[model samples]
Each structure stands twice: as C-alpha cells, then as structure tokens.
Target: MSPLVADELAQWAQYIQSATGIYLDGSKGYLIETRFAPLLKEVGTTSFGELLRRTQVDTTGALRRKVVDAITTNETSFFRDNSPFELLQHKLIPDLIDTRNRSTGAVRPIPIRIWSAACSTGQEVYSIAMLFHELKVDLKRFDVRIFGTDISDRALAAASRGTFAKMEIDRGLPLDRLGRYFATDGQTYRVKDEIRAMATFRSINLLEPFTFPHKFDLVLCRNVAIYFTERDKARLFGSIARVMAPDGTLLIGSTETITGICPQFEPKRHVRSVFYSLKVNGS
Candidate 1:
C-alpha cells in the first residue's frame, strides 16, 4: 500500500470522528496508517484514501465495522485500576443496597443495575460480578444485572465468549479470585457460569443518541471520553445522566473529569477514588 498522505489522513480523521466520535488530529496520521494497514491489505486497497472511500461506500457495513474494530482501542483488563473496584466493593455497593432496602424492604429482591460503558472484552463486567460473589451478596436477595457496551463488534464478541488467554488473566486478576471465578481450559480460562450469568454485553455508540428501558444504579464510563472532542464529551455525559437513577453513581477514568464539561453530575470522593452523582436539582 502507498503511504497515507496529508489529504487522506485529514479525510480519515474526519470520517472516524463522525462515525466513532474519536478525534484524530494530524499528528495521529501514523495511527490511522498503522491501524488500518492490515485492513488495506485485506481489502486489496492500494492507498489509504482508497480504503476510506471503500469503507464509506460499502453497503453491507461489513467494511465499516472492520474499520471501527481496527481503529478503536480496546485496552482493558480485569479491574484495570484498583481504586474504582475498591470503591465499588467498599462503599458503592453497600451504600446502594442500604438505600434500596429502605424503599423496597428487606424481603424483596433489591435490583442493582450497573452499566460499564466501553467495557472492552468484559474484564470490568466480570470484575464487578466477582465482587458480588466476594461480598457474599445473596443473588436471591439482590437482583444484580451488569450491562457492558462498546462500539467494536469484535470486542463485544470476545466479551460474550467469556474466555481469556493466560496473559489477559494475569493483568489485575488475583490468583485466589481467578481459581474461584474461572474454569481452566488448557492455557485459557473462562468465567464461571455463575459470574457469566450476572453480566450482559451489547454494541453501542456513545456519541449517538441512545436510551435504555431502565435506569442504572451505577454507570462506569471510564477511559473513553478522552478520545472524543469537548463538545462530544459534553453530549456523551448529558445522555448518560438521563439514563441514570436519581441516586445513581458514575465513574470515569482516574485522569478524566466532568467538572467543567457536564454540570448535571456532582463529584463525590470516597477514600482515594472519586465518583459522580446526579446533583439533586440535576436529577
């Protein structure tokens, strides 16, 4: 394939932002080249511009999906950062249950709905499921449903499989927890049925308008907004606020913030971690 020229890079950057809301400036020209090079060869395109054009005109959307899969970064692991899960295990889950018990009563099964946005390959979703088990949260007493969504179909497929290679299991997953939650299959491990049953996966574009039938008690949109532009970031969080329960909590990347971007959410701190809640008025 020929080199990706300035014009082609600009067009690709624009197209990527439009389709996936991931901003790619001129400096990221090499990224477009590096990520799309394989697709170029597979599609028999001689140049980056040709590949972009093919993707745009492909009616089946198969090529477009491939482009999305190739372009979007799926960097994730089981409990990627320790603090958020720690917060969930120590504060969020307990506090949420206490709040729900008051309204629904102790006998009724309290619903705990969670959304892990851009949940690449299901690690975060499974991590949360494992926490419920570790806490000995009675599944009969608490109806726990963890929803995981991402833009890449490839990523979602891997997530749905509930299987991981040895390297994947090594990152952030402890040995004791692994033995308890995963079934060994040669060098690979699969999440146990009990843990797998607690979560669901789907494909969703956060930049586009979306709605859910029910409001989530906790939503984790971590490490994804940095890819989007400021306007899109505001739009993204605004939409998230709508689908959140009145007393719901939102967790973003440790390095990211919604402070100036979205006024609907108010930050709350617990130990070393920070999470967001809908302001009383905002809710």
Candidate 2:
C-alpha cells in the first residue's frame, strides 16, 4: 500500500469529519488505506484522489455509504466492559427504579429508556435487556425501552437480526445468561423474541442532528468519541445532553472523558467503574 499524499490526506480528513465527525490525520493514513483499499479496487479506482472524486460525483451516494461503512470502527463484544453492566445491575437500575417509583407513587408503569449510542451490532443493547431479565424486574410495572444506534447500515442490519455467531456469543457473554435469554441453533445463538422486542436498532450518525421521540434516562456513548475532534465532541455531547432527562445517566468509554467536552455532566464513580449524571448547581 502506498502512502496518501498530504493533499489527499487532508481531503479525506475533511470528508470524514463532514460525514461522520471522525477526524483522521496523517498518523491514520495507513488505516485509511487498509480499510478503503478494497472499496477503491472494487470501484476500479487506482488512486485515493480518484476514489474521492468518484464518491463526490456519485448521485446515489452508494460510494459514499461504502466509504463511511468501511471507515467506521464497529468493534464491540457482548458486555465488552464488565464494570458498567455490574454497576447497572447492582446500583444504577435499582436506584433509578426507586426514584421513578417514588415520583410516580407506584401509580403507573415506570418508563426507563436507554440509548446505546454508537452501538455496534446491538450487543450492548441486548446486554442491557438481558440485565433486566437477570434482575427479574416486573415488566408490568416498568415500560422499558432500549435503543441501539450506529453509523453503519450493515451493523444496524445485523443488530436488528438479533443473531450472533458462536465467537460473538462467547465474547463477554456469560454462559448462564446465554442459555436464559437466547435460543441456540447449532453454533449460532439468536436472542429470544422477548428480549429482542424490548429494543430497536437504527442507523444514526453522531455528527448529525438528533430527533429521538423521547428523552433517555440512560445514554451509553462508549469507546466512540476518541475519533472525534474536540469541537465535534462538544457538539455531540451537547446534543446528547439535550435529549437526556435532567437526572439521566451518561456513560462514555472507560478511557473517555467529558471533563472539558460537556460541562453539564459530572462524573460519579461506583466501585471500579464510573458513570456521569446531570450536574445540579449549588451542590
């Protein structure tokens, strides 16, 4: 693979940022080449500049979609990081339920909506649903909804299918939970309809405007912000804050931070893990 010219690298950086808020620099030139090489060959282009030109002139936007999908990192596993789920199971869900129940006087079913931002292939969404099952929360008393959104159409399609390969199931998924929530067919496992029905998957770009129908009680934007520019990170979290309940919980990557990115969220640590909540003034 040849190195991308400085001009071509800058062009791609702008295209990627404009399309997905992902900032690519010279250091990532090899990544761009490796990810887009097949697409470039399939499109019969010999140069990155030619590929960019073709994508720009593509009226159907097919080339652009291919490029974006190829570039977006869809790396994830079921319960990829253990601490977050542990926190959710042992503390967050219980506390939230209690808070909501008290506010409503147990008069109506509690609504607990969660958004798995940059949710790749729906593992995290289903994982959250599985937790509810594990907790044996009464569905009649709670109207729970989980939404998994990602930038890749292919990833969303797989997520919507609710099927996972053996390796995918084995990674970060507990065997007991697997048997309880999934129906096995040979080596592959399919999430049971009950769990699948609790969640929805959509193709969403974090850089764009959000129009969710309801504000979320919990939002997980994990392990996905390292690719964004500082300016874009501020914009992304600002929009997220707007769609969050005043007391909603926000979870970013274990290594990621909103310290200087979004001021509305303040970090709270539970044991070894950390989560964020809306900062109340004068506290």
Structure candidate 2, residue pairs in collision: none
Off by over 4 Å in 1: 104-107
Q: Per-residue lDDT tens digits of candidate 1, residues 1-283?
A: 7988998988999999999999998899889889998898899877999899899999999999999999999999998889999999999998887788778444467778999999989999999999999888889988999999999999999999999999999899999999899999688999999999999999999998898988999999999999999999999999999999999999999999999999999999888999999999983
Residues 235-263, candidate 2, lDDT per residue (tens digit)? Answer: 88888988998889998988888886788
Pairs clashing within candidate 1: none
Per-residue lDDT value at 205 in model 1: 98
Q: How close to the true structure is residue 228 of candidate 2, measured as C-alpha lDDT?
A: 92
Lowest-sum lDDT 10-residue window in model 2:
101-110
Clash tally for model 1: 0
